[model samples]
Target: MQPLDAMSVFEKVSVADIPARSARRSKTTPLREAISALLPEEAFYVPYFDQETGEGFKPSTVAQVVGRMSKDSADYRYSVRSEASKNGCYIICNPKPSNG
Candidate 1:
């Protein structure tokens, strides 16, 4: 698969997509609340880990929120995969493709 441009993903994600509750909140809104409100259904939520140590990295906070939310909502979708690469581990979010 081709590499995804992280900035492109961020550019595409609109604040309008976030729920009204989150959008109306002050900047001091909690991280978990912001992330949970922003994420759309069926988004590809990938969480990275150290290939050697098998420990979560910086993006783990978002992963933890998504993991917890997944237990309650069937709309969330995510996967775990192991691959060898020179680059360090990192997580990402991408919009899922439509069937049509």
Candidate 2:
């Protein structure tokens, strides 16, 4: 869905944002890792693109991968949302830093 207003904000996360597993750590999905590498918005929305790799991912594939994680995933302290744009479907990851 499209963002209802212009005030909505998001941040792209990175592999660095994700913590390493503990001796009893939880599992991480491929989707979760990818979402972490997205771009976060400061004043405005920035589209998803991997600068280090000089490549991008299909929004649809992103959405599906993240969706799977939501069903059976660890608490990564970030949330994923999909939005519609003139270009196509895009994904956003909102940071929710956790202390655990």
Candidate 3:
């Protein structure tokens, strides 16, 4: 048997030959607005990172937003679990029940 040619296995098509589709709108809500709407008993997941790392942890925006909000409020209570794949963590926010 002869050796297989890698390029010969696949067919190449021109970019212009591809079908055109309409642009889809983004479904993303503003971060602050979304965070502000969280129910007291609701738990949300956010990615986290370590500031001090000769290891391999980068800063996460979700983590920062949650942290800032927690610092700004006395009633905010949260639990975090290390879930997901490598270098990822989940911040589960469990805020205290409001008086009202």
Candidate 4:
């Protein structure tokens, strides 16, 4: 008796025979997801923005990033921006900072 090759057996399998796994939508909102993804921990602040001056600043770790992001106004459009540095983060202001 001849043994069947694994590759040949695999090729014979029909796509319909395989069970499909359903992808469930995430319960967290996009805002939360982005925030969490950008700031995975709480060790340090991400320096998202200056609470008083409303200027963006860069922080090193994910925690710093999240901490900084947490200080931002939850309802503000600027909070949606996520980047590694202050230059990349969003700053809601008129006549944006000259250095930025």
Candidate 5:
């Protein structure tokens, strides 16, 4: 897995299976149902703006890329984006800065 500054996972999730377990949601739980979770808090926001115009993106108008480590030993997706969100993929990302 690649080194990432942070990780993120869906705000909501479930773990019921087979015979069916009590459908309960616990905020304090450490996301056990998920085989692994990505905590995207580490992603940096790279604000893209027109060079000539100082004006920049709106609340939801942002795009970006991120390199995050895999939460589990198995293969997994590195990042996610939110559509429908005016924030365009609700979350914007950027790479961590390198030491000079």
Candidate 6:
């Protein structure tokens, strides 16, 4: 598939382009199948990847690719789409920030 560089950062990522396994609807799947609906409702901490580790913050394109390229599986990787209440507050990746 081609890269989605044409999409802007503020664009709403569509599900049609994203694969079913990679695209998860919180309220659709079975009760036992809802990982996002687990014990805590902290979707903010949706956990794209561990920040402490050296892993980089994945771009929306990569996430879309993941969504369009795979099925939900034991090893299926995914990115919890940002639910930022404020628009234009996209997550920063490089040179981590601190609370101080």
In lDDT terms, which candidate is top? 3
Q: Where is the poorest 10-residue window by lDDT in model 3?
A: 25-34
lDDT of each: 0.44, 0.48, 0.57, 0.41, 0.36, 0.37
TM-score: the better of candidates 1 and 6: 1
What's the C-alpha lDDT at position 88 in model 1? 28
The stretch of ten residues in a row with the least summed lDDT in candidate 4 is 37-46
- Model 5, residue 65: what's the lDDT? 24
lDDT of 6 by residue, 1-100 (tens): 6579975578678889876686665422332233323332222222333367633333453344435432342333333446445221122122223336
Q: Measured by TM-score, how close is model 5 to the native structure? A: 0.18
- Residue 19, model 6: Cα distance from true site in angstroms: 34
How are the candidates ranked when ordered by lDDT, highest leading?
Answer: 3, 2, 1, 4, 6, 5
User: Mind sharing the TM-score for model 1?
Assistant: 0.27
Model 3 off-target regions past 4 Å?
1-29, 45-59, 79-82, 85-91, 96-100
Task: Answer with 5 or 6, whichever has the higher TM-score.
Answer: 6
Instruction: Report RMSD (Å) for each prediction in the order shown.
Output: 19.4, 19.6, 14.9, 14.1, 18.4, 17.9
Winner of 2 and 5 under lDDT: 2
lDDT of 1: 0.44
Whichever of 1 and 2 has more TM-score, that candidate is: 2
Clashing pairs in 1: none
- What candidate 4 gets wrong by more than 4 Å, as runs, is 1-11, 24-100
| lDDT by residue for model 5 (56-84), tens | 34322232222223333234434435444
TM-score of 2: 0.30
Q: Tens digit of lDDT per residue, candidate 2, span 1-100?
A: 6667865677779989988876642233434555556544411232444568654446555555666644453443234343445333444444444566
Residue 64 lDDT, candidate 5, scale 0-100: 21
Q: Which one wins by lDDT: 1 or 2?
A: 2
